[model samples]
Target: MNGDVHVDLKTDSRYAGRLQYSCSNKICTLRITDLRESDSAEYKFRFITNQPGGRFTGSPGVTLSVRGLQVQVRRSSVSYWATLMCYSSCHLPDHSSYVWYKNGQKIQRETFSSYSGNFYYPDSYSCAVKGLEGFPSPSVCGHGHSCNRVTYTDRSICAVKGSSVNISCIYNSYDTDIRSKFWFSPERSLQWQNPSQPEDLSEDSQYAGRVQVLETERGRSTLRITDLRESDSAEYHFKFTAGSFEWRSSLPGTTLTVTDPDLQVQVIRSTDYTYNQAELLCHSSCRLPDHSSYIWFKNGQKIQTETSSSYSDYFDSADSYSCALKGLEGFPSPSVCVYGQTCNRVTYTDRSICAFKGSSVDISCTYNSYYTDIRSKFWFSPERSLQWQNPSQPEDLSEDSQYAGRVQVLETERGRSTLRITDLRESDSAEYHFKFTAGSFEWRSSLPGTTLTVTDPDLQVQVIRSTVYKNYTEAELLCHSSCRLPDRPSYVWFKNGQKMESVETSSYKDQFYPRDIISCALKGHEDFPSPSVCEFNRLFQRRYNTN
Candidate 1:
């Protein structure tokens, strides 16, 4: 149907016997009994209908195309159970029967006289036929530069005691749920044994009480495994049967690795001080905690005994210790350690300085220890030098409108604290400052600010082609942006100059590798398509959010 074609049939005969005629409705029917000698240019059907006046002659042709075993996967490194859809289309009024096969071996599953379908199973999938003729080699969504090639995020890592892990095999097959899908191991038989059990088959074979399909909401699914055990590591396979079509499994193996959440504290530094008289003070730190606490340690251990501090020895007459040992000051320099380990690692790592209007860079900071609890971590770009503007507040120093969306911290968890920034324009770069507070102890920063270069976030746009015969898929434009987020930046996905959103005020964000990489993928499916990521100023304004 993509192009135009002209076809015709002709034959001459004078004296002939009564010719046979066969056709259901107004269509012509051609019958061939021989298989080996049936190699011809076309299959022609002649129709001669007797009318009241005379007889009319009409004929038609059906092209015969023979297909072979051909299956493809978008990514060569995808996990097992990933979807592998097999399909083929042709011009036909009605099909009598349909069948499928693998390596020439007949496949026994669901059959479809209709052409296209999918397989959620893992393995090789292909098709054969009975009444229909001509087939083509199948192709899959393989890996390459195109985004449509199905790049995966390696979310296959599952936790031992966690809930079912979702493995979304997303790709528009434009078919129904019944289509066969391949779910299997590429190297070995993919299987999952209970994480809480032994590796012997004496319990249960293939997946013996271990693997389960993750639930689907809004039509997305993932393969899940619970009670993660060491032996529950293996590839799984899924093969599909759709009419005469079969496709092989191209998904990578799904393995189950056991991981447990654990953390411990180890004191790396401790010192007793007695700068002057009756007060005894000490300082100590450990592997530290991110965004959690600021508890002080005393007498070789956590301050498991005291609560408040009152005084400190002369202490160099420079830096003052909070709530020191008042009465103990005279009893020799008593131990008074103030711990500062609760800085959010994900939000306060790589502390850096931002750039000015004409030239600037992003600030960074991270906290990965297991000490004190983190309070609030923030950044100051060149303090009073660089130009500033916040979308919410005014750009004034003390309470100036300095930063808005650009100032951010990673969503706090039990283990990390860090920050990232993006969309760095010239005025948006410079010495970015870092300030973190854990419990009662506060840590401002290290020396000057972290410098950022706003030359341009590595950005580019491109197009993608599809191997599947033109279906109901849309032409999508891909936008790629690469930048190291020093501060947590609100990635504003923009389509043209306007933003892509359900609400003008609500902001959307997802987390990736903290501190190192952050990406914003907004589908560009409209005309005049141009996608971009914008990180607004935070100090100058208030972050806009629905929450």
Candidate 2:
């Protein structure tokens, strides 16, 4: 049967004239010819005897794997030699010898499936079985090189901070005498340079003593970076100089994303309160290596029996759970309360916020307690805490002199609280955390909380596009902001300090002259407007003007 659908041996065109079956003295045989890769499947034989209820089907099925030979390339660790192997889906006979070809010419006869040699660029290699010389593997260039191109081994990689990563690539050039080669990140280059020069990663002070370049193979290079930081996240490109010519493709190169090593326990399956059991999986932004063990924590204590990444256990409503990597126990995940109530926990509604200057924002969160009576609660910013105060004591935001009359904490709901801040200043940009005390226990403030960023509200009119027509000049203007505004607020456009009616969007397009001045403001805050800019700026007009 083909996946649940029966295949007729006599009428099915796919198997017609190719399949044969015969039975003699209770011995059965089946045969097929010209097997295709699609024919690979688990096949079972069924038969029926003359007696009633004698129909019998095989308990297990035979698995068939039809595959063609592929040329796989592997490089030596200490030398420039590489091994080209004739690989297939199924294992070949141990006694069989293989034939190798270099540039379509017969090269050697090997007893094994692989051939080792000092392979170099511009040389192509293939392999085939000794008897089946006509079915040769597809030719693969040495070191994965093709003429004058650089191919990255991986397009993107995500790694945790403080971990090491290796970015590799294989490059080939028409001129084999390479003079210089190195890796660089365009994102980290200086913007002031007219033609941005690629700075070698090894020379960058930021990567000093932490970067190394390896060129053990003929055309392969690897950039190893250790003690990674989140700021190191960027696109990495390889560059090489062959004679006077330099090669650096304009296309995007391998992107390396360095994330924090924080772990989180994700709920795979949650049961009702009656069952009080759930399946939880430890997760991280960057994937951990295979077979990495995990450590589970319940109510601030480690659970010794659980070592796998996932755990299933009965939990009480007051119990909170967390996880961490076995070796990196210093950075454990924030504890998550089960059932979302009756636990000493605080969950912020939003993790980050961006607000305009002189505006107001509401940072809210839901808090819970295992005890009925509450002792005290307040909001604070650890970053702005006074050093003179007691290190263990958290000062309330309401009592802070900087936010004397601008901050208010409102607890309108039984379990919800919102902190509203008015007249936002740039100094207000800091992480805001909520804390509450129930009896003798206080919610953990080490867990990540909402971060607020107060940015300048002034908008700038940027020239997105410009067209120089025979009769007039048409340009598209965009009201740009340094920080994203909340709620997708509508924008008000102004021409020479006069509000432009009928156009309330963030963008405007029309025939513009050199004297036209354009600006923008938020819909409700029209009193504060962006600085007017000339329509035909020298930089923009120079880009489109045809002298």
Candidate 3:
């Protein structure tokens, strides 16, 4: 039973279909399927015989916990090597050995919680418990990359027409002497004389005055487009030449989709009819900037108090509603009749997501059909190449060999579906679209979908001089990551491969000798420690000598 509610294993909607109970002469067992985090709880078993006062209850009960595995990357900024630790949400047996995989191929000899090695870009990595190899952590990309590599900040972006958008990327080259670097688009060059040549946006007459490529940092560049138009939508790539080689322009870059400047009011009715209220949203095809403000109108009259994108109140069938940008009030959206319009669309919870490699992610969408019974639904990725299948058919993600044993589509409630992907890999980066079929109707596949970008997590050890002394130096060490850890995990420090006791914080301060080496890791993942760094480096020694 869950908190005073008798868990009806046979008839209740929540448990009846998924829970199975079996009994032997002296032993009984309960089985549950399609488990969720919410199912983590205490359970008690009770049995009653025909005789009076013969009922028996198992005291204390049994606690069940469910958890997922995650891969944590640890590295120092100065080193090329990274340490990968397979961690679980809940603690496992201390003796548990881990299995490691690189680019889906298992590493033969790795059997520890952590593995340290030189990780490079393009290749993905993951880990699992030795006995549970089927349930590995999501695949992650390496923090380091080969010299000639370019990484885009975003894989795809959707922008409203007439608005500005910036597509950025960072490039690296081994050659210190650079030749030239510029942004180009293959789509624009298709119509040019040399169809095979890359066309720089700066030289294109279409974007002459509106495009600017700004080098914000040494290796980072931003292509800012002002007063965007539908014609400006294309795949933008960055190319650079150094020494004898040029970065390939054929590699996939950022995809930009420019949409029309139109809006619609999405009506979400309240489940309870007695309330007679509905939630209204000023919906746009493409996601707007976070700082954008909206204006709401009811029956052609501006609602002064409703400036946000969403509004909720009791609705009247006679009323009509519309919305517009705060500054562009003249171009308001077409009015939508309340309770009279047919609704058929899919709204994603997030337009885009940047997730850590070797992690699980859920892409969810709420779908509505006008007036027919929904029949079938599935999720597919348009980014997947159709070289091996029918070109006209969109293959489901579940049927794709690349995502076998890693993808699941869940429909826990009506009108909502969630796509859960485990052991995420950099190759899994794509646009995922959901399709549903109703009586005589099917959701359009041309509609925009959610974009997923999988990136590798990085950890580094930062050293700061706290105090100076004649013979030695006192310094503070910090364990840093590219992103915040989920639970503010406790840290473990190591000095020359030996674990330091009683130190659990990310920061550690102490006096050190010239021969000392330092490294760190998350607590309970001691096997995968950060690359060790000499506590006393040449720079520190020089400073001491000068003093």
What digit string (tens of lDDT, one per residue) describes model 2 on residues 156-214?
67777777889999777767788989999887643212223577888888899999999
The TM-score values for the models, in the order shown, are 0.23, 0.52, 0.37
Put down candidate 1 lDDT per residue, 1-547, tens digits, no spaces: 1143122221111101112335677655543321221233455543322333233333555666533334444332344323333343434335434455433344556355332333333223444344332331332332221111111223134332232343345322322343544344432311113221223222245445755554354333355545454444544333433444443333332334443211112221213323222242222111111222223322222343443322222333212122112221211121222334322222323433422222223234443323356665555555444455543222322243444455455545544434455444565555555555566645442233345545433434332221111222122323444444224333334443555564221133322111112123323213322233221211011122211
Which sections of candidate 3 miss by over 4 Å?
Answer: 1-146, 190-194, 268-278, 301-306, 327-334, 337-547
Worst 10 residues of 2 by lDDT: 188-197
Worst 10 residues of 1 by lDDT: 9-18
Q: How close is candidate 1 to the true structure, as a TM-score?
A: 0.23
Sort the predicted structures by TM-score, highest score first.
2, 3, 1
Across 491-526, the per-residue lDDT of candidate 3 in tens digits comes to 888887787898889998988776788898876555
| Cα RMSDs, all models | 32.0, 15.8, 25.9
Q: In model 3, what lDDT does residue 342 have?
A: 48
Q: 281 in model 1: Cα distance from truth in Å?
A: 26
